[model samples]
Target: MEQVFFNEAAQDLKTIHDLLRWSVTCFSAANLWYGHGTDNAWDEAVQLVFPALYLPIDSQRDMCSGRLTYSERKRVIKLIQRRINERIPVSYLTNKSWFCGQEFYVDKRVVIPRSPIGELISQEFAGLISDKPQKILDMCTGSGCIAISCSLVFPESKIDAVDISEDALAITKKNICRHGVKKNVTPILSDLFSNMPHKHYDLIIANPPYVNVKDLKSLPHEYLHEPRLGLITGDNSLTLVLRILGSLKDYLAFHGIFICEVGNSMSDLITQFPDIPFTWIEFDQGGDGVFMMTKEQIIDMINLYPIFNV
Candidate 1:
């Protein structure tokens, strides 16, 4: 890739479209990772440019042709430089991320909200859940996006958003308040379900740190900016997952649904527990490594073996 040179003398580079194009070029040249919130240079460019210019991401194409002011140009250039050089995720740069069609404030303190669990929340867990969840638990909730989304989806439900990191819980509180779901969503400091042994939920959703030790070392530079506690698990990436499964039955309602995203550890999960029935969820919007199981299914598995003996 040729080095992207930003030329101030170029007259054609005055418009938003020009800056966006230049950003895309620079991002591609730098080989920046886009798995944070976007999957490609173009989308990442849009995310960087649109937010910097105070424009909506879905703004009209004609708006892109609008000329950028001198200050706007400088700001966009600086952002692009940091993006390329620091390998920071655009969401962290902008301090904002969108999940389940809702916007939430984000920073390095919490992982960017990119969980596929959002797809299930958007559908209100249709096929998997029959009744409207009265109690919800967003275990390992980073920015509390899942819990906040659930509060909106199930207006009558009260949600507990738990995270072991106080910093993450602080951010989660801000997001819950930002989304105006503070009344229904509570941020709790807990290492999984440790702080809520007696509490139970009708629906429990988690996007835990399932990245294996080996994969963690090989993650792109952009991912390195995120908190390690929110990504790495163990050698096989099933340490925390197994712990969650072991204690899940005790905290789930009679007909509760437990949904979790194990990322690349899905294969390991299947291999480790071949007898357990794990319903891998498919998303039309594009995401994988998530699975769902009902309370009854968990109970049956517990009965068959001492799976939950941990």
Candidate 2:
């Protein structure tokens, strides 16, 4: 039984190193999927164990040999078990996630912040937008990570973090407060641009649901813990994305740029709009299916594809 293993681990696992090793072994044996924050059992073990012990993620190697208190060991054991049994991502377990080298609060209400858009933000969206944006929009801003990160990068800019789900907006507000971007980041409850202000934005970013029905059904168990509202992009997958593209020109300034992540729906987007020129961004840090386009391009695309002119 799990209780027996807990007792044995509590008795036999003498130090952080022992517990970390045990966690890695258990995770590997369970064949847990690791895509939220970490990719391997060892790193996943460290993420779960170090945080449970209130130890710094960058704690020295010597600290691994240090003994853990009974309570600390028990907490780590329970978290590890929950991760394996529930197939929850480590960030959700810890209520923490990182983007653009900054930490944010997250839970089941929002998908864990792992968008490749962080790399683009870290570079200040260089070469994409010619000038500093005075206004920005983060569509489908779940945890408000993208909007908060942009606010930090462009403190002078006013940002709108829009999400249809009130629960998600709550998380977004929590993150906005956590990151101290309350002055610039405003959370709005809207289905895409339905309730957005009439003014146009100098920059627009989105990480909307783009998982196709086929891919959704085959996703790893760990992904099942994330909200369906934040993952499924309708049965055809391009439904929400097409709507975004259709209405994007209304919100994007003349010189502004639009960025979005469609994940595996990249093919669907291309198939649906073959002539639209979308510049797919390549990240050195590693992610795909994110693309960037300018306001002019969206206008042109709409002109060519009138069906997208909603």
The TM-score leader among the candidates is 2
Q: What is the C-alpha lDDT profile of model 2 across 1-114, one tens digit per residue?
A: 267877788877889999989988999988889798777899888877877787777794969889878888888888988888888899988887778988788899999999
lDDT of 1 at 68: 74
Residue-by-residue lDDT tens digits, candidate 1, 1-310: 2224443513347988888888888888888888977899999999888888788889948698798777778777878878887888999888879999998889889989998888888898889888899999999999899999999999999999999999999999898878888889988898888888587789998888988889978888889999888878767688898788878888999878899999888898888889988999889989899998988888787777675664
Off by over 4 Å in 1: 1-4, 7-12
Predict model 1's lDDT versus the native. 0.86
lDDT of 1 at 176: 81
Candidate 2 local accuracy as lDDT? 0.88
> Model 1 Cα displacement at 131 (Å)?
1.3
Model 1 error, position 220 (Å): 1.4
Q: State in Å the error of residue 81, model 1.
A: 1.1
What clash pairs does model 1 have? none
Sequence-dependent TM-score of model 1: 0.94
